[model samples]
Target chain A: MIALYTALITGAIMAGLQAASAAPPGGEFPSKVPVPADNPMTPRKIHLGKQLYFDPRLSLSGDVSCDTCHNVAGNGSDGLPLSFGVLGRVDRPRHAPTVFNSAFNTVQFWDGRAKSLEDQAKGPLLNPIEMGMPSSGAIVKRLAGIPGYRREFARVFGGKTPITFEHVVQAIATYERTLVTPDSPYDRYLKGDKNALDKSAKQGMHEVSDLGCASCHAGAMFDNPGLPMGTGWFRKFPMIPTNPTCATYVREYHLADDPGRFDVTHKQSDEHVFKVPSLRNVAVLAPYFQNGSVGSLRTAVRVMAACQLGKTLTGLQTTNIVAFLNSLTGKFPVETMPHLPETPDSTSMMQVAKLQQNQRQLN
Target chain B: MIALYTALITGAIMAGLQAASAAPPGGEFPSKVPVPADNPMTPRKIHLGKQLYFDPRLSLSGDVSCDTCHNVAGNGSDGLPLSFGVLGRVDRPRHAPTVFNSAFNTVQFWDGRAKSLEDQAKGPLLNPIEMGMPSSGAIVKRLAGIPGYRREFARVFGGKTPITFEHVVQAIATYERTLVTPDSPYDRYLKGDKNALDKSAKQGMHEVSDLGCASCHAGAMFDNPGLPMGTGWFRKFPMIPTNPTCATYVREYHLADDPGRFDVTHKQSDEHVFKVPSLRNVAVLAPYFQNGSVGSLRTAVRVMAACQLGKTLTGLQTTNIVAFLNSLTGKFPVETMPHLPETPDSTSMMQVAKLQQNQRQLN
Candidate 1:
């Protein structure tokens, strides 16, 4: 009887620990992301990807690079309503979403246009309105011309074509996967840190679960890349059977207009439903929603409530939800970008050239 | 006699070892600066100084500050025939001298008018043509209003009351003195570092002593504050006794016209002579004469040779001398200026009302 009682007590204690640590229904996320077989994650690829992400020379203007939009200093997104790209000061059509925990998305892009980060990476580089490199060939030639880059490319890519668009995309994707949002107050509170989150955040999180936001955004990686042991393939996130919120999209499954995954797959059932975004550091990233219709977090919650739960949240409840969203923010590494060489063939060069020109004019 | 020979051999070997370990004569400097006493270096302060140095807040029209002409990043002097101050484009009459070793000077300003750095600090703040604050009292009142500055000022210079002009000057002076040059190749060579300098720098340094440049520019803190142990109390620098090549002024005991020392004493014999400027980093500091009549190091050397030595430097010799001047470019401690509050209600408010007004209009 004593041994049996001890066993029962130990089981109860383990359950209690689980209750404390498990994401309070809403904050639960996937454990891992699905990676394509061709471009496997490697240390070399990650290193190269990090370098490419920071190199401003990748852009045609050499100024409005990826860093201009997704500033590491300002929690991924540049805290702007929409990004300013290439030569134009005019705002972009969509908000620059945070790349903090994007790896586990069932599909990338607000429209669910791309299947993987590798697929997503290629879209931006070729989006003439973005980096505005004339052509991939031109970019390759330019990179090849830089002797340091030529040597580095050879070392990283294992004698593969040093200047291919595919290699570039693969490297960038590898780097993106490494950018996981680590332990936040939400995670810590789950992991026995009772005081990690305040009353407001905890209350907001409970509301988030009640509203069924966790149905689509679930587990460690947030979005469902699909059932781990069952099917390895990518599907529209928030599997309909599991999430009642997904039922709304089921009626419009047959509709042909930008049928989210159906466009990529041609399957009638895979329609309209898109990957849910991670809420990590979501408080700081402004201009919410796929079309950036919602500017404030409170408004975003209300819209989601109306769309997903078919219920309107009170103003105080919305404020609490926003506070919870803020609690999900993760600590970021504070490393600086490498001191890249100041090329004489650029701004300083032009200044020097102008001086020379003025001298000629004087003579 | 045997012991003396052994000592000489050991000294020679140590000197050789030092020369082998030394760094190259001159190159680019490190991005960050070191801090010193009465002023602990911090990123916030340095950032503030960088902004202030670049900012026109100190000017009447918000178009000029200390950095308007004396560009700190560009070897602490503007590369111009003469520096501009009041008006954005108006060039000031005299060549803005390099501020590299100004901290070590016994007296400051072109005429040796200021006794100490503390005395020299407020001159530009209220100089109608320079920073142009109305009065010392106005500046203090302005600073007293800024809330952010109040805390910083209290911490940096004790409680706010009697936070007079002296604190302002002292803080700035403290910041300036810490701008000591880093270990140069020569310094390393002295310390027994091999390969610290190249063959050219070594050959050039030998020529530096031969050309009599060291007469005025002497010791680690180059410009002689006053060689009390050597010559009389004070002597005009770069001007040797009995130099017939001096075309502008003649001196029996002292130059009669400029009367460098006489300006203070009204002694006609002490006229037309100025304290010699330091030649450390002279290669980078252009517009080299007191009046900035000479533009380059080579030109300055030639002018000095003709005037002081009654000998004209050959083209190669002038090049060699400039190379030697290049050798003197030592490592300087780069410090970040602590951020003092700029707001009117802050503890350490800077007196920049006109600048604030201009900024508001721009915004």
Candidate 2:
């Protein structure tokens, strides 16, 4: 074991270090992600969740859809600094984070307000600023009004809890778990094919550790390992002094006023301590940071370097970081994504309700 | 040439007469279909149109998408005598037509009310019972509101016409033209490859001719070579003594209220003079006739035989006709259809306007 001690330090450092930038270039993704026995993933639930995602009826204005912000083909995030919510086309307080790998977060949201992905899924629906659904009961009522959803929910979650916010969240959460990014260049490099990463990408990865980003984004999930609320890695991100709401941070071009964990806990120490987001597909996801205050990948690295590590990154270092980030963009999963439903079901209860509503109004 | 002298009158009739059930197959699909220059077919336009065809936005209730009744998969028609429309959850008025080769229609729709596929495309959107859009203007407004849609329409249609109803129809018509069903076993059999079709299917095809179903459903595109509206044969269909609305056939379950062609023209001669729908893929497109009163392919054939040929079909004939109809079922081009715009601009704009309106009220 002691034949060559040159590997000792590297092994020790690498043992607990996350392989975030180390995955196969082109590998098969799991046909399906596993779910807890308590919440099984059925085609019915996924189908229901997909409908909910696309259904504008879920929003208060009957306009905002989940797919509006998290476009499946548009690299998950809607390529905006911040997403627009209901009431008006007002920008959200924070960036619209990618839905990918969200299942791994023990606590969801930048502030870790929600305890699980299910809880997180439910948050936007009830948020007056987002979907503006009157309440979870209202959401259930709307969903129940659609007969197909009712039938599907009954089939998947059992006939008992036919319609509930909990069921909706659970179904959505199950679907969310399947949104993992897979088979990036980093992954290929890690699987023993060293040529997967170009020279610059490898150099950039070395700089990632040197810059201390690994301190927070640490694990296969690229998030702090399931540390809830007060227990996780904590660091105060920079904030402008004068903001009364203390709600978000502001940079030169973009606004960065995400109070992060502070808004949820109201603890002084929690102020600006945002949950570290995964860097997978970070190259495509611009307007980085909790508030999306950083417009570019390189600038985001710079901000993180200056604000968290108290060091300004060199221009080359920033470019290298971006190059490394590009390595994390995963393979597009075409096979596992569900086929479009063969036909639009006219008999769907949602259709029935809409028809009834139209008839009644006309009469 | 002297080729005409070798054919005797009796010999000519026997040799020239093709089975009505069987069409000349084993030929390549025509490359040019006389598209108007303004709406030329390109790979991009067809691709975009296909997506729009399958998308549900064409419907008002957010259910009953285009593919609902005209099934692109599952043999190109919803296996129903009459397919439901918006609010027609339990009962449908007319049989959903097979879209396999609807592009060949000289005048589209069962009534021949529309002069072209483009005109036919607009029918459903404006029909109160079909898509149920408030107005063509509303549809244009809705589509124009979506950024992705704007981009796509601009790309496909040369420029944005503010996403007018015309654009929608044209796009759909363009897509529908590309849906020609591919070569079937019958086509190969017709190519002098006698072994292509099974003994039973070929035998059934001969029976189809003897029964005279091909008198109307004829040629490469089917229907009359000259008259697109009338059945292309000499024999008149049986009529009810009570009304000329039965000019073509005596049938129960006639929506006597809907005089197919008569409603469009207000002409007595047009009464019951429904366009002769090609029987290709009729096996899959069940619930036949202007009013989809017939439930099965066998029933449809029997009804046609009894009314047109003045002969009551035996169970054996019905089965044989069904076999022949099944021969028409073949492969259809399938690719990813267009998705509804995630951030529909009209919806978004309406949302913003509503917000402003609400804010003003609040103030």
Which candidate ranks first by DockQ, i.e. highest?
A: 2
Q: Estimate each model's TM-score.
A: 0.51, 0.54
Across B220-332, the per-residue lDDT of candidate 1 in tens digits comes to 44555233211222455445535555553333212233445566668765665566666666765555555444544565676677667777667777776666666667755
Candidate 1 C-alpha lDDT tens digits along A89-204: 22233456766666655557765677667777776665666666778886676567545566667877866587687788778788777766667787677556879889888888
- Evaluated on chain A only, model 2 obtains a TM-score of 0.78
lDDT of each: 0.53, 0.57
For model 2, how does the per-residue alpha-carbon lDDT over A1-363 read when each residue is reduced to its tens digit?
Answer: 101212113222343353565421122222334345567676778766765665555665444556546654445655444455543334345667877656545466777777666767787888876667879888787667555566777887786777788888887777776667777887666555679888888888888776677776655545553343223445566633344322222335333445668777888778767766776777766656665545556666766666666666788888877788788877654422232222112222222233333333432
**Cα lDDT for residue A13, candidate 1:** 41
Top candidate (lDDT): 2
TM-score (chain B only), all candidates: 0.71, 0.78
Task: Please give the range of 10 consecutive residues that has the lowest summed lDDT in model 1 chain B.
Answer: B1-10
Off by over 4 Å in 2: A1-363, B1-34, B58-64, B80-92, B159-165, B226-257, B337-341, B344-363
